[model samples]
Target: MSVLLNLREAHPALHTHPTPVLPPWPRVVVLPANRSPYGLDLPLDGTATVAVRPYVTAHEQRERRRELALATLGLDTPGPYWIHGLEVA
Candidate 1:
């Protein structure tokens, strides 16, 4: 039960502009359970299959979390998280 930012919509300019491509691994950002962006209180209580490959680095993880927190306007809090590349299976 987690929320994920729709990256494509979040940064349309970056997504559509000509920039060096980044790997999908770094694009995944999962919000903690019971948390959702401001205004859109979407319920997340359904089961969904997912596969994850853990990828972590203390510095990088912290930075990523911080960035997400700012982007979400504090709706997302920076906290402990093991970065992972996830795929819906």
Candidate 2:
């Protein structure tokens, strides 16, 4: 079983708005299961999915925006990015 949490609703300050539009290849941040305060008693064997819309770096945002603009003008957009399965140990 997998547990999912919306960090934005849980800790708004940590996930402030104006969420950046990520590029085809974006950075990922992972938090360990033991670090969560709310899941102290939960089984460590299960997996947890931390859904977060992270803020991208300014440069990344600019690049993504530029791609969007080109797309709006009927130009070729960037290639797709895949989200492989998440692992919990």
Candidate 3:
């Protein structure tokens, strides 16, 4: 069985919601564990999972443009996006 299958069978409550519009500023995302290539030693402990699809906001787009402009001028100081873990669930 696939990870998605295991997730659904073991956790029927796991449902996907429509992706919502993100804020103009950068937000954080907590990535779930890998659930691919079935038959791994992974286990789902009765927890539900959610997937999110994020799009670039106008402000973010402008920021990216600014960053690119700075990079062209050799003054780029871009920050990294962090992916947190879901331990509480």
Candidate 4:
């Protein structure tokens, strides 16, 4: 069985974005400044259906696995992701 990974709360500001139509669900993750877009680049889809809870919240930053965050925002949850950057590994 695919076990859901644990996630830690983080600052939303860290998720520097370029404006997106969020579906009030999926959590947004910001990639580092030095990384370019290529892998883990998911665009926001208007017709997404997923209840996104707070993967991480402000003042609650903690270490998390990369795969877990991906699953939460990837196909599993939705908001169109509304993300602009990738999470750390």
- Predictions: Cα RMSD each: 38.0, 37.0, 34.7, 42.1
Global fold similarity of model 1 (TM-score): 0.21
Clashing pairs in 2: none
**Model 3, TM vs. native:** 0.26
Tell me which of candidates 2 and 3 scores higher on lDDT.
3
Instruction: Give the distance in Å from residue 84's predicted Cα in candidate 4 to where it truly belongs.
Output: 1.4
TM per prediction: 0.21, 0.27, 0.26, 0.15
lDDT of 3 at 88: 18
Q: List pairs with backbone clashes in candidate 4.
A: 9-56, 9-57, 25-52, 31-85, 31-86
lDDT per residue as tens, model 3, 2-41:
9878888887656867679976976688899877777767
**Which lDDT tens digits does candidate 4 get at residues 1-89?**
12322221334455567777767876788876764457545666757866545765422333234434766876344333223365332
lDDT, model 1: 0.58
Preferred candidate (TM-score higher): 3 or 4: 3
Candidate 3 residue pairs in clash (backbone atoms < 3 Å): none
Candidate 4's TM-score reads: 0.15
Global lDDT of each candidate:
0.58, 0.59, 0.63, 0.49
Q: In lDDT terms, which candidate is top?
A: 3
In order of listing, the candidates' clash counts read 0, 0, 0, 5
| Shift of residue 30 alpha carbon in model 1, Å | 52
Query: Which candidate, 1 or 2, has the higher lDDT?
Result: 2
Which number leads on TM-score? 2
- Comparing 2 with 4 on TM-score, the higher-scoring candidate is 2
- Flag the better candidate by lDDT, 3 or 4: 3
Given candidate 3, what's the lDDT at residue 66? 78
